[model samples]
Target chain A: MTALLEVDDLTVGFERDGTRSAAVRGVSFEVAAGERVGIVGESGSGKSVTAQAVMRLLPLSAEVGGAVRFAGDDVLGYDAKRLAGWRGSDIAMVFQDPMSSLNPLLRIGTQLTEGLRRHRGLSKPAAREEAARLLRTVGIADAERRLRDYPHSFSGGMRQRVCIAIAAACTPKLIIADEPTTALDVTVQAQVLDLMDELTDRHGTATVLISHDLGVVSSFCDRILIMYAGRVVEAGPADDIIARPAHPYTRALLDSIPRLHGELPRRLPAIPGSPPFGTVPADRCSFADRCPRVQDVCRTNDPALEPTATGRPAACFFPLDSVPVEVR
Target chain B: MSRFLLRRLPQALIVLFGVVTLAFLMTHVVPGDPARLIAGPNASAATVASIHHELGLDRSLGYQYWTYLRQAVQGDLGTSYALQGTSVASAIGHALPVSAAVAVLGVLWEVLLGVPIGIIAAYRPRGLLDRATTFGSLIGLSAPPFWLGLLLLYALAYKSSVFPLSGYSNPYINYLILPSFTLGLGGAAWYARLTRTNMLEALRSPYVQTARAKGMPESVILLRHCLRNVLSPLLTMLGMDLGYFLGGVVVIESVFGLPGVGKLTFDAIGTLDIPMITGAVLFAALFIVVMNLLVDLAYAAIDPRVRR
Candidate 1:
């Protein structure tokens, strides 16, 4: 069956002072209907940019070259009118910063009901009723009266919930949540993640969860894609990848997650160097400089994503062994 | 809201008192004498003295100020020495509506023209329309009001007869058109630049991006979402501009020959009409105070965070 969403050879670049540098380079992925996919990466991994590009929400200066197909239809070819109609109704997005994602000047009800009225074409009363229902579905108590309150009246977690409700209000086919709980407290973060997982599951909606927290992604997503320097360095089912990270970068990422059960080590094993700044050479591996198992050929030849012994795709000349590497 | 106003009223009164006292002292220190001007340059010393006595100008400065303050509280601004039998309040009353009409119309012109141009400029930065508006507003900001007024009067009034040359007339809008345009052009330029900067900032804000991500039309995003956020700063600019327009339209009023408060104040200053000047100064101070209060109230209304 055709995937619900297919992104092929996606590349996003920004031009400044006559120099064009790609942020997301030749990235490809797919999500089946009702599937949960997580794009995991550190900061500047182009994960958020990829989400924005799929939605066609990037600024005009961004040069996007790729085919983004939703339900076998081309999204990149849509004009402004069609794009407006396609967004929010067919696909919706939830942003990272809940504080800024919601308009401060608007009341919670107005913000919620606006998309419903416009996309769903519901009457005012009906839309408002649906808004209250969505709020309740997101676990906000007193949803009706709370709708009249502005965003400032809500706590950080509650505000993120409100944002999620807005995203879920129209029952879109796909939802792109970019670090939805990154700005919330740890306790609140788990609650919000639970709410999202439950609601999206109930709705049978496909989700693309972009986050820096591998634990959060693994807990909720069916499959995961690891990104480094704007490229998808690894992709596989969540269980297999978490069990045995095929790419060295992915292994590094998995190792970096602090364990609560283990005896405390002298120091945490951080990745040796910072993520490559700006753009890496077009013909070379982005993570070669930091790769612990780097070989001479890895520096000269850019690796294409190839199936590993475990049947997962990893863009590495030397895939790491399946055996878990011991932490020092 | 009522509590906010109640708290603000006494502060407003204090400001008004300070303004009036300063006007009183400054006008007193000036070399011009109202009695001498009223009696005439040819009048004898006795005539001038008698005129001064009648007007209580010969009294000690403190006594005069005390008596003036007492009478002022009772809504009596004394009488205009330059215009016999005309109360300072009455002279102001006659001129006020004319000045207010010009100022209001000027602000209307500024908002209606300036805000949209600014929004458009910001929406398409560095485009043709943006470049044109930026350049146009620069000229508007640089040109003096009187010079701009005369240029408009010459071209639109004298040359084309599209409008009357000068003076208030029936359907006073015709007379106000040129003067108000001149008065508002500079302010409009200011608003346009401010709105453009604010619009650009608002458009970049995360909430605006959220609105865009919602699949709302660009116009709706710009108007409803972006513009509402832009109002707080815009209202602040309007408040300051309104204060200046109310009492600072002397050049525009004189150029247009409109009997507005500004023109009345201008005439009072020339002839050293102390009562009329004092009355006009107090009127302006009161108007500005009230306007600022309304702006504060408007802020609370637009932004709920400030409601408390």
Candidate 2:
């Protein structure tokens, strides 16, 4: 069966000062129907850009190449009119920063029902009913009354739930939630994630959850794709990848997460260098500078994402066979 | 909202009082005697003194101020020294509508022309239209109002005859076009620049990006999402601009020969009509204060956060 969404060798670049720098370079992934896929990376790792590219929501200055197919139809080829129709119905996106995701001037009912009326061809009254129902599904109590209130009236977590409700309003085939819980408090973040997971599952909608938090992704996603310097450095089943991160960068990212039950370390392990800025050379590994096990070949030549001995894809000459002791 | 107004009213009254007191003092302190000017430049000393005594100008400044305040409280702004038999209040009442009409029409032109240009320019920064608006606004900002009025009068009124050369017409609007346009052009340019800056900022806001992400059309996002956020600042500029328009009507009214309060004040200043000057300034201050209050109320209406 064809995947629900297929992103093949997607690349996104932006031109500044007459020089084009690739923000998302040659990243590829797929999501089957109802599958939960997470793209995990730190800030400026191009995971958010990839999600935006999949939705074709990037600014006009961004140059996108490669194919993004939704249900075997090329999403990248859609014109403005087709894209508009394709967007909220076929695929919807939940953005980071819930405070800003919803329009402050509009009432929650207006915002929630807008897409339903436009995409579902529901009447105003029917759309309001559906919007209230959707809000209820997202765990907002007194949904009917709350719909009349503005976004400013809601807490950060509640606002993110409203955003999710809007995204799931039409039961889109795919939902791209970029750092959906990043702006929420730690306690609120779990509730939002749980609500999102439940809603996506109930609606049978495929989800692409993008986050820099491995713990968040590992608990929620079925599959995980680790991005580094705009490229997918590792991809496998979430359980296997989390259990044993194949790429050094992925392992380092996993290591950076604070532990609760382990013997206390003097300080958390950190990746030695910051993420690359501006354009990185196409011939070399972008993370070579930060990699602890950097080899001559890692710097001299780029590593292609090929299946390792354990049957998971990783873009490194020497993939880690087991979880490192320092990280554990 | 009513509570907000009640709280603000006292402050507004204090400001108005300051304006009145300052106008009264400054007109008195200026080295021009209204009685001497009324008597004539070559008047004898006896004639000047008699005129001063008749006009109550011979009284102490404090006594004159007290009497003026008392009469002003009783709806009497005294009589215009320059225009015989014309009460300052009645003259102001007659001239105010003309000035108000010009200012209202000028502000209309400012919003109608400025906002669209600003939106178009901000929608596509560095495009041809943006560059054109930038250049046009530069000229509008730099050009003197009188010179611009004369140029428009020559081009459209005198030469082309599309509009009347000068003076108020029966319907009034016909004569208002050139002068208000000249008055509005500078403000339009200012509005355009301000709107452009505000719009560009609004468009870049994360909410706008979210609007786009919701699959809203560019027009819907620009108009509904961005424009409403831009309105708070735009309303502020509009209110302040209205004050400027009222005060600035002097140049436009003189150029067009319109019998507005602005022209009345100009003529009063030349003739050293202290009561007329004070009355007009007081009226202008009150108008501006009220406008600013209305703008704050409008801001609260548009942005719910402000209501808190």
Best by DockQ: 1
lDDT of 2 by residue, A20-121 (tens): 899999999999999999999888999999998988888889999999999999989988888888888888899999998788998999888878988889
Tens-place lDDT digits, model 1, residues A101-135: 89999999999998999999999999999999999
Query: What TM-score do all the candidates reach, one by one?
Result: 0.95, 0.96
Error of 1 at B216 (Å): 0.9
- What TM-score does chain A of each model score against the native chain A? 0.97, 0.97
Prediction 1 TM-score vs. true: 0.95
Is model 1 an incorrect, acceptable, medium or high docking prediction?
Answer: medium
Estimate the overall C-alpha local distance difference test score of candidate 2.
Answer: 0.89
Residue B189, model 1: Cα distance from true site in angstroms: 2.4
> Looking at model 1 chain A, which ten-residue stretch has the lowest summed lDDT?
A319-328
The 0-to-1 C-alpha lDDT of every candidate, in the order given, reads 0.90, 0.89
Chain B, TM-score, each prediction?
0.97, 0.97
The candidates' DockQ values read 0.77, 0.64
